[model samples]
Target chain A: MFTSKQMHLAQVFLKIFFRDRQSIIFNLLFPLIFMGVFVFFGGESEPINLGLVNNSSNTISQEFSELVEEEPLFNVTKGEESELKRQLFLGDQTAIIIIPESFNSIDETAEIKLLLDASQVRQIGSIKEAISKSLLSIERSLRNTQPMFMIKVEDVKSRPQRYVDFLLPGLLAFMLMNLSIAGSGFNIVEYRRRGILKRLFVTPIKPQDFIISIVVSRIVIVLMQLSVVLGLAILLLDIKIVGSLLSLYGMIVIGSFIFLCLGFSFGSIAKTQEAIRPIVTSFTFPQLILSGVFFPINSLPDMIQPIAHILPLSVIATGLRDIANDGVSLLMINLNTLGLFIWIILSFIVATKFFVWKEVAG
Target chain B: MNIIEVKNLLKTYPLPGNKKDSFNAVDGITFNIRLGEVYGILGPNGAGKTTTLEMLEGLKDINGGSALIDGLDVSNNAFKIKEIIGVQLQANEYFESLNLSELLILFGKLYSNEINTKNLLEKVGLLTKESAKPKELSGGQKQRFSIACALVNNPKVLFLDEPTTGLDPQAKRNLWNLVRELNVGGMTIVLTTHNMEEAESLCDRIAIMDKGKLIAEDTPQGLIDEYASEPIQETLKGNLEDVFLALTDHRLRD
Candidate 1:
């Protein structure tokens, strides 16, 4: 009996899923598109896009041009410092880091000014930081090691974590979870609003069977969608999975059920879409902030960390993070697995009992 | 034996924003329906007819009294009762994607095991529409299809809530004829409606209720003789509809 119901449910989920093309773009594609823009336009690029008109015949000026060419961050061209600065003002090359003929001799005591696009604060900050770091390396390696001045060279190693590598997967998981949990989860509320529950109430159907069928069907869809998004991330962004695929799949299955139950509970209790919108928003926002979907939740206040820990989002996020970062299995993270099931039970109880079927308006 | 029996049925709902106050939607109403008969409950709107039907169907809880169907209590034996009773609600919406055959088969699975919806649809004059979704059909076609769904469980008792509301005269006649045929074939039926003419033509007996109480209950002619000043037809006469109905026996021969 349940198998038949589950089949029917799968059919419903498939029909609804295929029919909705807009949500696919908004929920799935939107995140990847945002990431692409930042990585492309905002990232480090070639040195120059224009001709460098160099009037200086000085050796120091020629040396500076060669140095710029050697630097991967810059596609260096030869031009007078003043002309380069004018290009900076015209929104060219992000910012023109100019060096006068006297720049090579400045390592002894003089400071070199790096021109930045002051209007582009973020790019300017990153550009300035990168240039400053590189200059410090140059100063220590070449200038300080010489007997020209009483300068000491300290070898500093940069342990810069791949910032994009850490963030992109999290962003991908966040999108998948939101689409599965937040979007389709609230669809339960929509079903009630459409009086589908009322229709179900008139049947000889078991509530457990109905709910279980939905859970199964939704889990499959969520998993399928997450796979597609993950595929896009992998193909386009080269996102590598370091964790156990089994564990990742399990966490999502359990997490999807947990959040879907939360969705169901919200749908069941809310009187109208207006009432449900705020209630579900409150439920989901806390999960988003507390679960380390964007930032680490451990950074929250000491007093609030415990509260965050107990949230389904927190446990699911932790489980996902562990699986993603550590490749841990279900046995490796017993507490999270247990916590997820507990939440599923608690939320299902609330949803089953309070989920209103009547078309009561706000 | 009586297929359905109720004694002092009561249902109260908590009045919103009030902890102490409660409103009784079904106020100690009691009735019985024997097997192999069409029993209709008629009333004005807000008269607890739907509420009473909902309770008997186990869609709502009874605040007081006992209800037994086939000697099984309605409350404690909901699943047992549900398995045996087929229900069709007003506007009887199914998932917009489900075809006539699919829905019947689905409901049949809910009741028991695999089912053949072909014969059932044929009986309800919906054989041609087996593959058509509920939304694709007209109101009358949908209602008739709903009746076909209600019979899927091979239910001993069929409960319908205003089965003919929003239906055209021809469709309504078709439904009445179908109901009459079902009763003749020995299936008990319990229905709620505000249409007096429908009750007069199709129902074997009726319970007239108002304000959560049974005000009048008898055969349609008997209730009219007691309360109506004139003959039942004269009391609420239709200019031409009566002639149209009378000329064609209130059954769909086609």
Candidate 2:
């Protein structure tokens, strides 16, 4: 279905895209810089600084705080109750735990006071859970296995997904969307402004041929971007790609095509270059912020999460992470695949219906 | 045989914010272009000259009539029509960073026409500037490059709309000579110009339009012979400009 004319046009477009320094940075170098930063800071979670206050003479209290100190999740500091409380209140510690004097043995039950920094609401649950789990382990050592309650922790994946692993695929998806939407939209509007499309319309080449050329050219650029960014990420950040390379590329191709169609829709709707900015920003900015480029969709408000999850960028980013980090197959990522398919059809319809080949005067 | 025929071609546009109010941009104008002749549509700005030319070029839709090029309906067969017609729009812009030869080769590929890029550039006197970007070329060189691009398809009919509108006098004369040479090479030419001298010197026949209707149509000398009565002064036997001024009245269009 490809034509030589389309290939020739695509080659010409590549030359133009590369020759323009602004496009090179926007399309390629900026994303690479992002990858470098993300990879450098990837995977390492922040350590919570904790304050320990022991009032009891019991050795168990001393041992329990020592256990908590050894855990990588916390940076432990031991101090007097008043000082610890002051530090906790001053926002120097994430939480302060106090073991009272009466906390003795298996025969007696003693109360422990846990003063948590309420300002950091998001970390409260995890901190509470980790401390409680540690206490349970200490209690189990004291009281023999009553078997009243048993909880076993297990990882779902063969390997745990680090923050970098989470970020790499999302960045990839974001890069593809940026390349397609901004790149494609800017191109058509520029050609329209310059009357290039009007000039081409007088030729024997059909509009379909021109569109095909654009599609082909955009795909080539997207691929180059993917390889460069992903290559640097793999070499520098040590990002693990568990999924098939073919499948990852395949997903990106389909994903980029969807955004390219959206770009065309924006191009057709915008009458001039000035009009293009707001239109494209309106489309891209929402997805960039809300579509889980930096964080998971669940991190957003519950009311907006549903909307964010369905965004093309969200679906593609999440889907790529699933395949690359979770080792999920292409067919298994059906929700994202289905969402992208719907977008492709809808955007293609809008583009074809509203496409303006020449400047229409009022 | 007439190479192009227009029969009561019309284009009406609805007034903004008033759905029911409509006006004819080109109101049922009719004209035929003969084979190997330079036909000029002469009119001031906002005179609907461009609308008529664009409709025939398949760049605009005909609201109420028919136009045929080489006996093929323009509306139904715009693609086929485009294959055989070369167009130089008033604002002829091209892709940047592409040299003249690259742009021409790209244009030739669009038409599926195998063209000699060097020969095409030489015809427009831009062979020496073949490697220069379109933006780098001078205004007159740019116009010549646009013409070169248009001719890439080796078109049967060439259309130039105000092709010399922004050129210096020397460049304008150079373009006039180029147009004359193209016409002599047997390409049926249809151009629109508001310059009376351009029309008189370049066109074999002229159609003068004002406010969407043809006020007069004839050869340059024939128009003067028929309408140049009551010249500005008895001493100055008026030319084609006098014929145009006398027909349309001396008033600024804009």
Candidate 3:
């Protein structure tokens, strides 16, 4: 329900946004720079620095430690117990592994102690599982026993979930969310502070018309970011979209709309651009860290897992992955769509209720 | 004929953090602005000049009574009222990176009018800087651009709240000339200012309000004649500032 006037205003917004170098930096270049960094060093680029405090002289333990040193994911460093503990505490190392003196004993029980920072919730579980698997293989080789049991993971979806495939959708979602939240929020606060809204209020333009113009302009920007990130990801990173392209775009559009509403809510709260920054960052940072954007949800801490699953970013990211990487249909993502709609409605209400059209005269 | 009529208009703002204590910013003030004349509301700071202007502009809700613009109730027909009135806010900032021409066109479209951006810029003496962004314009150029934006809708009435508050003397004089030119072109103007000289020279009739109440309303010459009649040391002397000082007590309200 947009009038021609709003559409024209949207065109002006696009002109200004593209012409401003600062806006171009945030809207276009930042996403590309992030994508370039991500593509250059894959998702597992950050090698986990680990310290090995080996007390065991046994050949099995030594062999296991040597095997761990060979993993591409781990950068193993040999150090004394006290020194490694300091490194782990200082966060200079991700984790430290202590192999006890009786680690290779057949008659006595031995334990492998994994000293890790609990705050590194996303990596702790996977790191533990990988170490356990490596040691189990070593124990199996020493015993020279017949094969026991094997576990297999099969992708029930149409496409294989490569690391790039998983990351591409989340990265696209991140870019869209950032553009809508930080981009739209700061713009709203800036206009409000500068009396643009007040001047518009004195004109014949309705509030709805002004908001529609903003949404349409931000949507255009969001689409641009989408194409850039997805194009680079597909062309250079080999991330394939197995689902219908139209369906993927539809999901992205709806997800971006939800964030835009949240942006308005924040814009209503912060009266100036300076105040809006910390407020918006506080809201987006938690979602970025906890909301399965960069890592799988299950790897997070138990208490944080449920909250992360329920966040709007988590739903959007998971939904995009399911449709693009898993070839799922819109109907299959009913819950995610409903959750996002609920958020949109709630945020829209809060935004309109608190929206400051003009500064009140004292 | 009166182009604007206000009747007992009141606006009470709730005291922050205390709903029980509320103060009336504009208390039962009433006045009429004749058609085709510039009306000035002259007051010191915090005298509700802006609050009154906003109420008449249909930007704020009136707690009591009513205001009418061109025979239409402002409270009920605010949207319609907005269509026929141009407003120049004190802080006039538009979308950054848009030159004057582009900004005018966009603003004109908001009112559903096809404005001649170049012609309007030329009329405001901003034709050469039509391509200059708002940030690149000088203070005087920015004020001219703001007035150009206001005129884009072809409004019947123009409301400017402290139009020249932050400008230099040259810019202020330049804006005064623009206001006179616009008024002569048949637009009813309502402006608020604390500068006695501005109100004296630009306004045909001035309403002096203090502490949210109208203290005096008369032509600038009439006010001087009325207030200056009291002989000071066997000599009569009065200016607009003397009239303002004689009427209102010199103290901050709050």
- Which candidate ranks first by lDDT, i.e. highest? 2
Model 2 misses residue B29 by how many Å? 0.6
Question: lDDT of model 3 at residue A91?
Answer: 83
Q: Model 3: per-residue lDDT, tens digit, A84-127?
A: 88888888888888988878865566787888888854657877
Give the range of the ten consecutive residues with the poorest summed lDDT in model 1 chain A.
A155-164
Query: Candidate 3: which stretches are off by over 4 Å?
Result: A28-159, A272-275, A301-304, A331-333, A348-362, B16-18, B230-254
Predicted model with the maximum TM-score: 3
Candidate 2 wrongly placed segments (more than 4 Å):
A47-153, A331-333, A356-362, B230-254
Give every candidate's TM-score on chain A: 0.66, 0.77, 0.77
- Model 2 shows how many backbone clashes? 0
Higher-ranked by TM-score: 2 or 3 = 3
Which residue ranges in model 1 land beyond 4 Å of their true spot? A1-120, A123-128, A134-168, A182-184, A232-239, A285-311, A334-362, B16-19, B229-238, B242-254
Per-residue CA lDDT of model 1 for A132-180, tens digit only, reads 6655555555434643445565535223324455555456456545655
Each candidate's interface RMSD (Å, one decimal) is 3.7, 2.1, 2.2
lDDT of the candidates, in the order given = 0.72, 0.83, 0.82
The deviation in Å at residue B71 for candidate 2 is: 1.7
For candidate 1, the docking band is acceptable
Write model 3 residue lDDT over B131-223, tens digit each, in one string: 888998877788788999999988999998898887766667778988999999999999999988899999999999998888899999889
Instruction: Kindly report the docking quality category of candidate 3.
Output: medium
